[model samples]
Target: MTTYPPNIAKLFEPRPRLKYLEHIDIAPKERSTPAVSGLSGYLAQLKSYDSEIQYTPTEGPIQKQQRERRERQRVQQAKVASDLARWNPSEDPQIQGDPFKTLFVGRLDYEVTELELQKKFAGFGPIERVRIVRDQRGKSRGYAFLIFNSEYDCRNAYKESNGMKINERELVTDIERGRTIKHWQPRRLGGGLGGRHYTKTRVWGGRTNTFGGPSGPRSVHQTRTAPRFGTRPAYSLRLGPTERRPYERQASNERPERDPRYGGKYGVYEKYKDVKTEAPYKYESRDSRDFRDRDARVPERREREPARDKKEDRTTRFDRSMY
Candidate 1:
């Protein structure tokens, strides 16, 4: 290589623009994030996955476990993606009945069949259809959709049936998100309200969640809904017990059931009516056997006490030690 002349070297040299007048600051290009595509959204979920996967002919215990975990995560994530893809809120064939009358049931036990769910929830309101979401292999995905005949019934079930335990799994109820809620996505799409995957680091929502939310069914039910499952009857404190409006149900019966029990919301349903309980007017069963208690060779009213004079007779301060 040879040095060029001054004029030629000057031509080869790049000219610099004045920074004050024309130069503009260019931002550094941002690092592009990995795109998730197809039926595999689990790529976003892998916190401990390796960037460079290396396979060994001979396997150690840790390596084998890691491999298995990775595979399991992949499969589970793929299933989630597939579910998201299959269910379209706008134009999906699987979704039947009115959107307003459909209730989304989540956190279901896979073993809980549709019949069992219907049986347990029937007390709430009459159901039109019960659909348990299943994968391509026909295995349960642990969620369901219940279609009620009326919107009132659907809302009642959503409010009252939420957190009800069936098959040892507490249920989570929601309105039909795809149609009812605008721009809502399922948990698989990463846009549901609550989740069961609350760890020590992140508690989104659960029974024992650290955020101190409602612990179980009782708390949620009492806070939100009336005691009974169906439509609440109109009543006033000024009115008598039998003066309240009848419960106009969309359930099986055409005639509304008139509840006459006198009290609060719990005054409606008599859960223990079938139970053979002792009469409220009558005292304890032990009252009938008072004679047996009197013959127990023990004094009653209170614990056996020393004679009043003996109690009054106190030893002197000097003689107290001797007593």
Candidate 2:
């Protein structure tokens, strides 16, 4: 241990001092009522008053929580019921509203550029950006998106540019609500020759497509019953190989058979094959005859000789004697 001066040792030594000020109480004080009317109390009360108006609900906290939960559940249930009631399975999903400040510019010509779109939309308001949606092949999808600095400008552009013709193409402008819906589409089963409007089954190329319900694209192997023809009673036997059932078969026994003698079905042409028809006038011959000859000159006839050159001498003697 090293020795030091008494005053120096005092500087190194731990000193004892009074823990309280003169005549001041240091022990735990007696309990006293809170000053509710004090200025600080008033300030705290004001803070609480703001909180009460904002969030300190009048009802019990548990009951308020339960009521809010019940309200949320009821709203959800109602939304689900409404969605169920309005649901159409056949319709494609559609986007309803616009959330972003983007406008959809449709019916754009393939030659139209982003600069042209920006220039056209800039007339309404300042455009933030212009994007013509393209595919992997880098060709425009016939639509473009235009983001504006404000929603007002977007709305203005959508309203003003709608149906406006550019480069001989009319524009279809609206807010970009994402996906579009086709309003008119063919029914699932019947598309063209055999559509759903047909009340019966229609078969083509050994495949059957039913028109009444949503059973679409059924093959011949999947069918349970025979398909019926359009509106006719079912026949016992099909008339032709291509024909299906349910058609009125024509009278097979009543029709006459083709004649086998005249080379079967072509018998009517047999008479006209080699037969030569005569003209209206009869053919004239080379020999001269009255009505048969076609020559213009008339034929001369021989004159009859006076009767009786042979018996002339005897007749003359008898006449002379009688005189």
Candidate 3:
């Protein structure tokens, strides 16, 4: 049996008085106690009141754990988003090639076949594959995608064949980055007004205006004509020759043989003959002849009475013997 100190026994007391033992352990004259004893006593007390002592984890430690979990989840979500953004069939394990080496195109001619396009573009570089999208009805959708073996080859093909002509049509090409390449075919020649190419118009002679002259429907008819000649007759009237009386001739001969006034070589009648002949007096004759004929018919008369008696007699007799 081990013997214990009297103070140790007091420690087990139900109610011990320790007011007089103040600083007893540290006093110079006090006996030093083994540290093991104090340790054993403390262990006993802990066991006796173990249920009464409660422990809780610190807020800082719990918060640190939750932050670490959140960081891990965030990193995983970012990875999933990045993978979705750059998803591509060429990047799949089954497909073997540089995924970045490809191009998409639109605005393609419907009449152009995929083989024809591939053949045309194969001259530029090595083409892995050419795909022309088609609808459910097996008709082309007018678009395509082109895959090249090398990035440099794809770039060269893009540069050389971007605006390359195919059947009088130009094509457009766009490089596909991380996303799936969309097939784009060139639009038809008559797709829209802006994409159409204009052709030069032609004019024919006689069909169009010739040298700025009139040109249209014309009629066939005569524009000119010609000219026509002949013979006809004339008209006249006549007065025939007639006999003269002796008395009229004698009366013409005796009419003023001479004038006593100066030598009557020519009478006033002779003087005015030219004027009177030009303007002869008109008269009606019994035989419908001129006045000359009627005057010639009259007989010449010589008066037998005295000059005074002739003068007194208003009427005078004519002797035909005077002719």
**lDDT top scorer:** 1
Among these predicted structures, which one has the highest TM-score? 1
| Candidate 3 Cα deviation (angstroms), residue 20 | 99
lDDT by residue (tens digit), candidate 3, 85-197: 55555555534445578766657888889899888888767888887878888788776778887788888877777787788878877675334435322223211222322
Clash pairs for candidate 1: none
- How does residue 221 of candidate 2 score in lDDT? 35
Ranked by TM-score, the better of candidates 1 and 2 is: 1
Model 2 pairs in collision:
190-195
Q: Show where candidate 2 strays beyond 4 Å.
A: 1-98, 179-323
Deviation in Å, model 2, residue 220 alpha carbon: 42
**What tens-digit string does per-residue lDDT give for candidate 1 at 1-323?**
13987877887887898578643654457446679678566765553365456555899999999999999989988988887777777787888999999998888888988999889878878999999999999999989999988899888998998889987788889888789877778766767776743333322223334443434543332244344645443332222122344555566566566556533456544555446334422324532222323333333432333323323444442253244
Q: Put the candidates in TM-score order, highest first.
A: 1, 3, 2
- For candidate 3, which ten residues in a row score worst on lDDT? 228-237
lDDT of 2: 0.61
Which regions of candidate 3 are displaced past 4 Å? Answer: 1-98, 178-323
